[model samples]
Target: METLSLLADGFSVALTPSNLFLAVVGCILGTVIGALPGLGPSNGVAILIPLAFSLGLDATAALVLMTAVYYGAMYGGRISSILLNIPGDEPALMTTLDGYPMAKAGRASDALVLSGVASFVGAFLATIGLILLAPMLARIAFLFGPAEYFALYLLAFSTLGGIASNNQAKAAIAACIGLGISMIGLDNNTGIARLTMGELHLMDGVDFLVAIVGLFAVTEVFVFIESHGKNSALGVKLGKITIPVKDILRCKWTMLRSTFIGFIAGVLPGAGASLGSFMAYSAEKSLVRDNSQFGKGDVRGVAAPEAGNNAAAGGALVPMLTLGVPGSGTTAVLLALLMTLNITPGPTLFTDRPDVVWGLIASLLIANVVLLLLNVPMVRLFVHILSVPPWVLLPGVTMISFVGIFSLSGSTFDLLLMIGFGAMGFFLRKLDVPTVPIILGILLGNNMEDSLRRAMVISGGEWTYLFSSGIAIGLWVAAVLGFVAPMFLRGKIRKPQAITD
Candidate 1:
């Protein structure tokens, strides 16, 4: 009953005339970004963070607009993957395996419609899961002590490094680098600068938004430049938006299973949308008899991963909202936005700021509906977004990143930092190492350190306090398994890779 009243209040806030307009515009812009190769939701939100501030929008309004874009981009990413054989991000990679083949077989329109419907189903169902589970989960979080939080953050990092990256050693190195970066600027405890390297601007830590935009948006621009003048064309004509009833019936089980898998995966720390999609694809292949058709344009093949990835996106929100710990790269960016807005997420957020929490949730429900309506009828409009030249789009994105960061602090140093990180990001991508863990490390590293220090203080510097509880012990065990299992799997796959290379 209380939840209902809060939701009603949220609707009142979200349905305001201006907020509604922003939501619509955000959805459209998000779709455009998602349809373009190399511009995922993280980059999309980071690039546009400046626009929200420039317009003088409040935190709630800005978050609603950004969240709308986040989901909208997830919907739009499928178009390029299906038509051009290019994934907008890692999660959409599975979509290309079957989606492109379907498009090549002259069913581009059908693939588009089916993917839209599947994405809507996954998102809607995941929202339902969030609505029901978030409050309960938040309540459970209230029981955690600093010791437990330290353990939880450790679990998050270990799991993230394990599941999000294929190479554990590389992932660990990336995480250490991010942690080192986070340690820059003045130390909170001693009030002394640690790693400024004698630069005056190094007194303040690197802005999260600047680092995100530089690492994702700026690096992406460099990559697109390398592909400049290449023949990356959308060849097939979009014939009609029609999803046959029989196909829906056939994939209904796949969709349902993928939703559960995605939600569970999203709830876990370090596990992300790509892992969810990959696991769902593998699960569907194992369950279906004619698995031989998976990479050759199987409809179920398309549905499972699409459903899983969208659901995972929603699932990633769980930890961010309830625990104040992000579960993925995109959520880490959202966490930065929340902090910038003076909104502190955690168990108390639900009680103290019911309006923001419920309003965002309600907006997500509306955004999914808006995305579905926009995607089906305006499919061609989204496809046309791909025709934009990189020269025009890259500069526009760079401008947005520059303006947003400057609006917050008006610092020239921030701009230089953005460019430096952008160059680093480009090289990181070239090395096949995941950037998500780096973002996760930067966002959570300080919190984890604080929690660990508090836990030790409470325990009188006793090391056994770290493993005092059954829950903490269990979490530690899980973290170890998460890190080790990937190494074993990678070793098995490495032998076959050597032959191919």
Candidate 2:
């Protein structure tokens, strides 16, 4: 009942005329962004952050808009996957395995509608799970001391590399790079300049938003430009859009099962949507009898991944909102946004600012419905995005990143720093190294350093105090397993491959 009352209050906030309009606009824009190849939820949210700031939205409104884009991107990824056999992002990779085959078989409309429904089921249920679980989890913060927090942050870093990266070594290297970057500027404790390199702007430290835009949005532009729009053509022909009720009914069980699997995966630190998609598809394949049609035009294949990834997207929110630990790359971006707004997320967040928590949650529910309605009618429009030339699209995205960053900071140095980060990201990508860990390291490095210092101060320089509590010890154990476990899990998990034209 208490949750219900709070949720009602959240609904009251979300239903305002301006907030509702933002939700709608965000959904439409997010879908378009997702439909374009290569821009996933992380980049989508990051690219729009400056716009949010320039518009001067309050905390709740900005959160609602960005999260709406997050959900919308999850839904829109399937468009390119089904139509062009090109995944808009990594999580949508599985959608291509079956979605492309279905399109090849001339059931493109069926596949699109079914995937949309599956995405809806997964996202809606996951949001409900967030509402029920996040508050309960927030209470766990009360048990955390400086030692425990340090351990927890360590766990995040360890697991993020293990789960999110193809190679733990490379992920660790990226994390080290991020941590090194975070150590720049003046030391918080001593008030002494450290890595400023004689630049005055370095005193305030690197701006989180600038780094995010550079690493995600600007890097995407460089990558796309390098590719020269080789895969921009749309070969699939769409007939009249039709709702495939029977197919949806057949996949209802698949959607529900995948949603549960995905939500759990997403809640785990660093697992994110890619793992959720893989797990759901693999589980369905194992559970079904005579699983011969998985890579073919199987509706269950479309349903499982679309549902799983979207649910995982929602589940990623659980840690970010309740624990201040992001469950996915996109949530990391959202966390930066929150911190920039001076809104600290954790246990007190629920009590001190029920409006932001509940309002964001309620807005997610609204966004899910809006995406469903918007996606169906606008299928033709989103599919047309595939026809957009890279020459036009690439420059537009680049402009947004540059203009938005400049408008936010009004610093020529920040712009130069952003381009530098973009170059770094491009090189890292060329080497197949993951950048998410780098972002995570930068986001958490300072806080982790503070927690360790505080723990040392409290324990009078006693090293053993770090392991004084069960929570701390457990976190350490989890950190080790999170790093090592992925090595074994990677082999067992079936990797998805894109279909060629």
Candidate 3:
């Protein structure tokens, strides 16, 4: 009943004329960004962070806009994946496997409708899980001390290293580089300048907005330019959107299982939607006897990943809101936005900012319905965007990105830094290192350092304090396992190559 009252209060805040308008606008813009190739939810949020600030939106309104965009992008990502065979991000990659094939088989409309419906089911179910689980998890977090926090941060970093990139060494290197970049500004504790390199702009360190745009958006432009004139011709025509009753009945079990898998994966720290989709696909493949038809235009295959990815997106929010820890790249961006708003996320957040928390949740429920309706008849409009030639589109995207960044800070030096980071990102992609961990490292690096230092201080320089508590020790063990498990899996995969060579 208390939760219900709080939700009512949240609705009061979320349903205001201005907030509602922002939510709708954000959903539309996010869908457009998601339909474009080489842009994902994180980049979309990053590019628009400045706009949110410029508009003078309060924390609640800003969050509403960003989260709306996040969900909208999830919906829009399927469009490109199905029609163009190009995934908008890692999570959408699984959708392309079956979705594109379905489009090729002239079932483009069917694929779009099924994926949209599955996404809605997954997302809505996960939202219920988030509402039920977040407060309980936050209560558990209330018992944590400095030692526990330190250990938890270590576990987050280690698991990020494990799950982010296939190559552990490259992942570690990316993390270290991000930490170094984050440390460039003035030290808050000691007021000592560290890595400013004598530049006035470096005094503020690198802006999160600048880093995200450079790494994801600007870097993508350079790649797009290399293949500038090339275009993929798509003949798939979108028709009426509807599911046969029989088809839904056939895939009911798959939907239920995938939803469970996605929600569970999303709740685990460091595991994102991609992992959920992959796990669901694997689970479904193993459960089905005729796995040979799994990837070749199977509707079940399309349903599993779409459902899993959307569920995972909802799941990722669980830790972010409850524990002040984000489970994915985009959530990490959300975390940054929260910090900028001066709203510290943790146990007290639910009590102190119930309006912000519940309003966002309620809005998500509304947005899910809105996205489904928007996708049904309007999907053909998104497909038309795919027809725009890369040569024309690349320059426009680049110009928009540059203008957005400059408008945000009005710093010429930051623009130069943006280009430099863009070059660095391109090189990192060529080396097969994941960029997500780098962002994670930058986002979490300072907090982890502060927790560790505080724990050490509280223990009077005793190293054993880190392992003194049962919770701390268990977390340390989990961190060790997270770091090692990936290496073991990689080794197993490489053994055959070594033997053959």
Highest TM-score model number: 2
Tens-place lDDT digits, model 2, residues 1-501: 999999999999999999999999889888988888878889888888888888889999999999999899999999989988889887898899889999999999899999999999999999999999999988888789999989988888888888777788998998898888889988889999998899899888888788888999888778877888788765547999999989999999999999999999999988889889988988998898868998898999999999999999999999898888898888999998898788998888998999999999999999999999988866887888778877788788889998989999899999999999998999999887889888888888898899999999999999999999999999999999999987998876433444465
TM-score, one value per model: 0.94, 0.98, 0.94
- Ten residues in sequence with the least summed lDDT for candidate 3: 492-501
132: Cα error in model 1, Å: 1.2
True-structure lDDT of candidate 1: 0.82
Clashing residue pairs in candidate 1, if any? 50-404, 160-270
How badly does each model clash, as a count of residue pairs? 2, 0, 0
Model 3 C-alpha lDDT per residue in residues 1-501, reported as the tens digit of each score: 877887788888888988888788878877777777777888777777767776778999999899999888887888888887887666787888888888888888888888888888888899888988998999989888888988887777677778655777787888788777888888866888888879887988888777877887788887776766544534546766666556556778888899899999888878878787777777887898777877788888888888898899999999898878888888887887887677888888998999899999988887888788777667777777666666666677678778878887899988998898889999998888878777877777777777888889999999999899888899899988887887878743221110100
Give me the runs in candidate 3 sitting further than 4 Å from their true place: 229-236, 491-501
Candidate No. with top lDDT: 2
All candidates' lDDT scores? 0.82, 0.89, 0.80
lDDT of 1 by residue, 160-228 (tens): 778677677888888887778888888776788988999888788877777888898888778878778
Give the root-mean-square deviation of each candidate in angstroms: 2.6, 1.4, 3.2
Model 1 misplaced stretches (Cα beyond 4 Å)? 229-231, 234-236, 491-501
| Cα distance off (Å), candidate 3, residue 459 | 0.9
